[model samples]
Target: MSELLNNSHRRKEVLMKLLMRLHEGESPDTLRTELAETLKGIPYAEVLQVEQEMISLGMPAEEVTQLCDAHSSVLSGLVDVGDAKAAPAGHPVDVFQQENKAILMTISQVRQELNTAIQSSGEDFKKSVIALRTHFNHLSDVDKHYKRKEFLVFPVLERQGLTAPPEVMWGKHDLIREQIKGIHEILLNPELTAEELQPVVDLVIEPALYALAEMVTKEEEILFPMCMDSFSENDWAQVHEHTLEYGFCIVDPVGNWKPTHTAETTAAKVESEVQSGHFQLPSGRLSAAEVQAIFNSVPFDMTFVDNEDKVKYFTQGTERIFSRNRAILGRNVLHCHPPASSNIVERILEDFRSGREERAAFWINMRGKMIHIEYFALRDEEQNYLGCLEVSQNVTRYRELEGEQRILSYGEKKSD
Candidate 1:
């Protein structure tokens, strides 16, 4: 172990020797055991340094992933040594770990099933191939999962002056994402026969599975440990609250975390103590007080655009399925969308302004809620051009309505 640690060169050289020993038909358990012991009791970043080195040395991504996972398992028991606290229920760390575990298990199962498909009979063969592709679609959730970590968790770590691991991990994440997307597309449109899937199995699917597995290890070992070391309890609490907005990859947490002191009430009390001016709605005849009430009372979100197509303002609805803060006010409407989507937004605005289209619609399902969105051109009393009105509402219940009745049937069950 001392000889293993004392080497001045990167650990990748040692790992290559160890991996070569395995390939050379030598017993690998001794070296693996030795490596694990050296990794134990070290700072998780040190372990990650070894991981990066191993990857650079032509060690299979899977082996490195396994090494990281093994390192984490060892550290899981010793985590109490640090000032780190258990991720309170629904904490980002807790949610990430739970979701990641399920994804890893699913990836493991898919890999095994595909392996069986390669060696199996006729009926089992097609079934395994289809299962592999179907699971590939499910793998998209893994990308979404990691994105949250990159955006949310990485920023917090960066603030603490630790930046290297997240960036490296994000790069590996992109590679894994591309591999999954490629495999999924191949499965969806088969340019390759089942026999040809063999290389994909080796090159794309296998490496991806290993990459995800390694990430899980790095998260549990390096990322989470470092986070726990760096973040305050309040930071975890804030993350836990935000988790509700983005949600988890696989795990559905049974409960939520609530701050001991209510930020909601404190905020409300502060707001009540402050002075706020009433707002004006697009309806020209309405009073400011009435406009405020009308906007707040409606069951939908509302936004206004001037005749020139600049986004003038948007209302803040508490039940908004998608967040829209005042920061977006007066910003170019195109800037609200992702770069890839800006052109489409501009086209819509053009059509609306030219009278080629007076309205456009779009909707999405989020967290089991179906949200309906619509944009309409608002004309004046003279029927001359004015602006566009954007309205969005949660229509989950609205879409379920059947035959309409005039009377208030109120609380009673309706017969089909």
Candidate 2:
């Protein structure tokens, strides 16, 4: 039995057969039992290989995506991770796992509150709904978690020809995102009663939470371990560097991680580029130092998304209303926003790309400050769309200005 399990060809064949059975509508419970009895444990890599092979053999990626959860459930405790590498403290994978732990804890709390709401009535149920809403809001933070994986980790995997898994996982991510959005919409009704909320809890809420938890399991047991085995130290270092842009989920990484081997850091590379030469614009030429200083000196935060929808540049203003980091440099602009907001972003991008809109503006009160944000469609001489530019500024002082001073006020003091 051990020798047969050791044979990679045979193991993958058996795994593929079981997964195909699941695709054919076999019961997950029956498959789980069969996997346990027949395979005992399958290497995590074989699981990915089998999926890739299936796709290569003419199975539509959508079909594989549809079967993702079912197969993951069937192989829940059956993936062999005995040889998985341990991530160093503060490594990207380590941080991802830590965030998963925090997400799981939040899920547990939500379940407890759900149980309370299930047995209660009237105000008590309303209170439970409020609690559930707060928990679900926290769960929405999982968007950042998924974005980091989608923008940073998945690209690296794709470059290695490990494309199918990311596609399947991204489809699952979208499904989970839609589920969370649906739950939010249902929870926002002011007239919702306990009777109305019960069906939603059973249908929408539980399923969303289950999907969220299941993805975490897939990441830790299969994805992360496989990445650790496949990626070089430098690959991890780059991932760690870019992680700050999407931000952490529930917990921040404890410390910094870098490869032991000497290599040029991102900061050092940037410095080298800055010192190399000048950037000649269509109107004027400026040294890299001058350009950097000008961007940083700008009062408003500015970000430019290229025609391809990738984040290409952002100003580094000292008092930015929104955070910016190099990690977001190549990320899709849509992925930079939460799932709830991505729809709005997509709409704006479409309008800009189609020349239907030139600009969009919005304002909100944040931490007692009124912030103004606007997006502009960039065009060339021929009116061809180049990209989108986002500008944000704190307009609290401007809004509160009583009157304009006739004279210079740089060193003037006002009397109360």
Candidate 3:
């Protein structure tokens, strides 16, 4: 080891090589000792500064985030991102921080309920469940937080050419969501006994609550700070305006700070840069909201995977055969499935991309309902492969309609 600290140029060169090694498939665990020796005594701001430099040089933020996450094993000792500055009243970060506090409180309550259940028996067991249900339901607020980040904030970052980090975070959001959903399912099970539910409560529920805690820390330490540095005042203003539409997590939005420049100041410069209103296609014109409504009104659930195999959107039909939420949006198609099922998802995308397959269909019986799932390859007029679309429908009622009647349907009568 050198007797003196390296100069700025030397330090940055070392940081880049370290990131490159991790990018080349070096396991974080294997590099832990070396990382500790190299960066352990260094301030956390170094990590942040190097990552910002990478973004400045056109490296994707997500790639930097991935390397950061992989090396997070040593972040506890080496990185002191320092105390997060307090966000003012009505500031976007303020609202998120408030929600994070609420989320943590609920998670604590859930732990208490679990301890009570562990200490109780028979009638006492049922009594503990009473408290458990409330805590579990409170955690549902996380969905709103995630939705705002994905739909409202991510697009702005994408416009700024930072897509990967948001995608990685969305994947984490989905994982958290699935765990929360599992906890909910346990709450709903009629025959669920304390003994049977104990393992799930411990493994699924506790891990999820802790994951949420870690996410809040990551947001405060890394994500939010990065956004503060990267997003423009107008971008923050627009995001702040749209955030209310998705609603809040555990806290309300507060703050009266306005940007120095409003839409008028940025209009002409960002007109086309801004994405709003209707899409003018050759077939027809419909605003995004109208298109969403039409998609929901349709009889089946639909999902669009983009050219890079990222999940771009999914329609929230009334009776969707599969479950979906904003967390899955912009997530990689491969991560959306379980490990065992990922092979099929990858094979399908390969076939679609290679122009070897146009469509794939399958049917199954789920919870006494018939499910018909299909995937189709999407292409441009020149046959350039675009992506894949997945549509799934519940066909139980359709299967039972064996005979047709000449009588007008009830819907037809209303039209007449």
Predicted structure 3: clash tally: 6
> Once model 2 is optimally superposed onto the true structure by TM-score, how far is the C-alpha of residue 213 displaced, in angstroms?
1.0
Candidate with top TM-score is: 2
Residue 358's lDDT within candidate 3 is 96
Task: Name every residue pair that clashes in candidate 1.
Answer: none
- Candidate 2 local lDDT, 1-416, one digit each (tens): 78866698888888889888899999999999988999898888888878889999989999988778888899999999999999888888998888899899999999999898878888898788778876776676687789889999999999999899899999899888899878877876868887787798788888888888889989988999999999877777678767776767655557566655633466457558768789888999999888889999989999999898877888987888888655456556765775447669989999999999999999999999999999999999999999999999999988877867657776688744
Per-candidate TM-score against the hidden true structure? 0.54, 0.67, 0.53
Local distance difference test values of all predictions, in order = 0.65, 0.84, 0.71
Give per-residue CA lDDT, model 1, range 208-298, as digits (tens). 7866776777677667876876776666655654553443464455445554556545444544543343445575555565667678778
Which scores greater on TM-score, model 2 or model 3? 2
TM-score for candidate 1, please give it.
0.54
Superposed Cα deviation of residue 163, candidate 1 (Å): 1.9
RMSD for each model, in Å, please? 10.4, 6.4, 12.3
**How well is each residue in 189-279 modelled by candidate 3, as lDDT tens digits?**
6566778877886678777776787778667666776676677777777777666556566444455654455643554444444445678
C-alpha lDDT (0 to 100) for residue 309 of candidate 2: 81
Q: How accurate is candidate 3 locally (lDDT)?
A: 0.71
Lowest lDDT sum, 10 consecutive residues, model 2, at 259-268
